[model samples]
Target: MASGDLAVGVVCLSQTVVGLMGNVSLLYHYLFLYFTGCRPRSTDLIVVHLIIANFLSLLSRGVPQTMAAFGSTLFLNDIGCKLVFYVHRVGRGVSISTTCLLSVFQVITISPRNSRWGELKEKAPRYTGFAIFLCWLPYMLVNIICLMYITGKWGNTNSTIKKDLGYCSGEGNNEISVSLCVPMLSMPDVFCVGLMLWASSSMVFILFRHQQRVQHIHKNDLSPRSSPESRATHSILVLVSMFVSSYILSCLLQVCIVFMDNPNILAVNASALISVCFPTLCPFILMSRVSREPRLSFAWIKITKSPKPIINM
Candidate 1:
């Protein structure tokens, strides 16, 4: 293998391994909390859904891309290519949807009781499961088109019309189909990204107003520990910012790939790497926030308020 290929393979392998481990550990933590009868926060369910989506995204894209980077070819057949691409698309969609949901939930959660959003605050948590279901449903149904257009390298007889994706090829002969599918696929993403941005901006405005109130109330105090709401809002803002930046870069790379007559290996590899950044970094971001908040415990052995007497033994 070429040294460049080796380097790319190693990076992809590292990302997949790291992202999988982070997401699995985070998932286990949440499941443990649920089984132990710990009452989870309203946003916890949404977060769990995000973790699952991230896992799927990393697994489906990272593994194949890594193999291809390492000079592996014709390893996947027709069915394999379709399944992998479909799963990646669905996972990517779900991730965006869930993140948007999480941001919107937080906005509702922190809204003042008198504001218009106050009504939604009471109802949002109750429908979180339904909302997450909605997130998964659209993508699963929409990305099924991948099954028709995507094929493995060996299955691609017409090199002139098919776009080679290293291990898989996508039929590009029908401009009508491409035009329709691209917009159909991208519409949901665009909507979700817009909502996420709006929510993030709302959060920033709320946080700023809140800070002014605090500073006015305590003029002598130069600093104060932020409230849980403030901390959570800050975390979500960070998450949203990272996701938006990564998503934009990935989309730009994808557009380049789509427009180019023949995209080079480096461009493809860079796009794959950029696509997984949010998934790989998200779990760590959440974990860090959880660690900083002592109230959100992840203790293996829950401590009781009252102990039994030892004299009987």
Candidate 2:
């Protein structure tokens, strides 16, 4: 790398790290406050889990790329390639699974008692951990092909397109090039999209139903601004909504990465921008939930200020 190129890389890397690290630190502090002092609710558990997921996502996807941006370019040298990529793949896979679990858990949590899903809702906390575990299964198993196919080889004009940052796979003259494309090209993206939709839809439906019931029950007595359940629901919904948006951006960016195969700095810039910023949003999403004060002040007072009930409606 030339001196100017190295200088630019350093600035880019420093900017990325500073932004993400600051947000991540805020996430940790809020998590500590919520876990140690705040009310012990199941929602707290899910948020905590989301934080963990975000941490791993940063470690897996963000760290390596950041390092490559500022540090040495030629990494994962023959053996290191598989190791770095393998660890990073597992991290990204865990991130995807965690988001899926987040959606499912919220759906189950908000389901009505009269609904058939009530039984499943009760099982949510117990199974949340297990569901997160289950999510890692496919990503890990299928990504074995990455280890087999990828190596530390530079791509001149002759190489397969890459999706992930600091992730060079099926590049250069590799034995697994022809072997891996069938599964890589079709299966993974389809599977992720399908599962993401299924999880998100179920959650949205349950939340919508819950909110409608709340509004109807309190009809014309709308003196109270909001309910605790409504506020909690809103928080989770926003968090999941952010996840959904990030996932869409990630998928599209990956597609773009594949489409712009040739060495164009514009493609590289857009792709890098997405890859670097993706995981960073996870921390911000969590922090956003914490910073937003509960909208249901009356509901909170119902429990906290039980001695005094001011009737207006």
Candidate 3:
């Protein structure tokens, strides 16, 4: 293998391994909590869904890119390509949708009791399962388009115009199909991203107003400890900001790939790397949030010193 290919392969491998480990660890913790009869927070369910989606995204995108980088060729057949691409798209869609749902749900959870959204506070957790089902259902149905357009390396040999995606190829001969499919796939993502941005902005404004109130209430105290709501909001904002940055950069690289007559290996590798950043980082962010919660410590047991009988040491 070339030196550059070796480097790309190593990086991709490291990303896949680390992402999978983080996601699995988080998943196990949540599952353990559920089975052990601990009552989890309302957002815990949503976070679990997010972890599963991230796991799928990393496995679908990272593994193949790593293999291709290490100089593997024609390893997958038509069915394999279709399945991999479909799973990746589904995972990507669900990740965005779940994040949006989490943000909106938090906004509802924290709204003032007299406000319109306040009514949802008691009812939101009841509908979390339905909301998650909705997030997965549409994406699973919509991304079937991938099955039609994608093919393996050995398939579609006669097609003169195709987009090479390392181990798989996208047949782009029909202009009409390309035009229709691209928009159909992208519209949902754009809509979800818009919702996330709106939700994040609302959270920021709410936090600002809340901080002002705290400062006013504690005028003499210079450093008031933040509330749990503030900490959770901050974490979500950080997650959303990271997601947007990575998503935009990945989309730009994909656009470059689309416009180029032949995209270089570097561009393709970079795009794949950027696309998985949010998934890789998401678990760690949430883990930090979980650790900060006083009632939900991950240690599972508290160590306390015992009193010794009256013998002077």
Candidate 4:
């Protein structure tokens, strides 16, 4: 391998390790909370599942890509390729779905008492449970095509086949199947992105009205203290923005790679690195809002303040 490839390999390794650690930390901390008899909120439940999805994405995609960077591109077998790619796609879908669910829950939680969604607040837990359950089914179904298409072959002859390193090109005979699956792969993601945008915009409107009410009540105070719901909404908005930004950058780079007659290896690696960043950086973004005061003797156990009053609607 070239020195540049080695450097890229090292960087990929570092990202995988860091992402795994962050997701694992969040998962362990929440499981500990469960063991200690503290009730985890609905948001916490969604976060727990999101962390799992992130961890799986890192394992199934990031680790393999890092290995490929180190010149192990052909190490995987057909079955391994299918499984890894399937899990990676599903994990990504789940992460998107869970984030959308979280945003919608936050919007409902903070809506005005007479608003339509606000009345649904009391049933949030049940709805959350249902949504979480529903999130996995479509993703799992959509990626089933991987089993038939993905293979581990070095020089695949089919021009129409999609080539993922360490995986074989998808078979071309099933063009119709591929066409149907294409929409399945992306429709849910587009839908979730739409939901996130809607929720965040609604949040800003609610916050504006709230600020107006507060200003009317206290004429002298220009900087009204933000409610926890507002803070949570802001945090969710930032996270969604980060997710969308990373996805768009990665997609643009990928399109560039496809058009280039001879795409550089380092450029491809950079695209791979950028693609998985949402899972890698999300936990730290969340940790930024956590309380710094130590709540436990254990070094890893930083107790974050509870989310806004979600139950009151």
Candidate 3: where are CA atoms >4 Å away?
217-223, 297-313
Candidate 2: give its CA RMSD in angstroms: 7.7
Model 3 per-residue lDDT tens digits across residues 164-202: 888888665566876787788888889989999999998
lDDT of 1 at 236: 88
The clash count for each model shown is 0, 2, 0, 1
Sequence-dependent TM-score of model 2: 0.69
Model 4 C-alpha lDDT per residue in residues 1-313, reported as the tens digit of each score: 8887788788878889999888877777777766654655778888888898898888987888888878878777677778887998899889888888888888888898898887788888777778898888889987786687677655445566654443233444445765576666778888988998898888889888888877766677676566667777788888888887887787677556544444556667878788678899988876654333132223333333435442585
As for model 1, its CA RMSD to the true structure in angstroms is: 2.8
lDDT accuracy of residue 124 in candidate 2: 68
lDDT of 2 by residue, 173-290 (tens): 3335644554564465456556767766776676677667777666767585654454555655665566566667766765554444343444444554554454666666555555
Global lDDT of each candidate: 0.85, 0.57, 0.84, 0.75
Give me the displacement of residue 73 in model 3, in angstroms.
2.3
Candidate 2 runs further than 4 Å off: 1-49, 67-71, 153-170, 173-189, 214-223, 256-265, 291-313
Give candidate 2's error at residue 157 in angstroms: 15
Clashing pairs in 1: none
**TM per model?**
0.92, 0.69, 0.91, 0.82
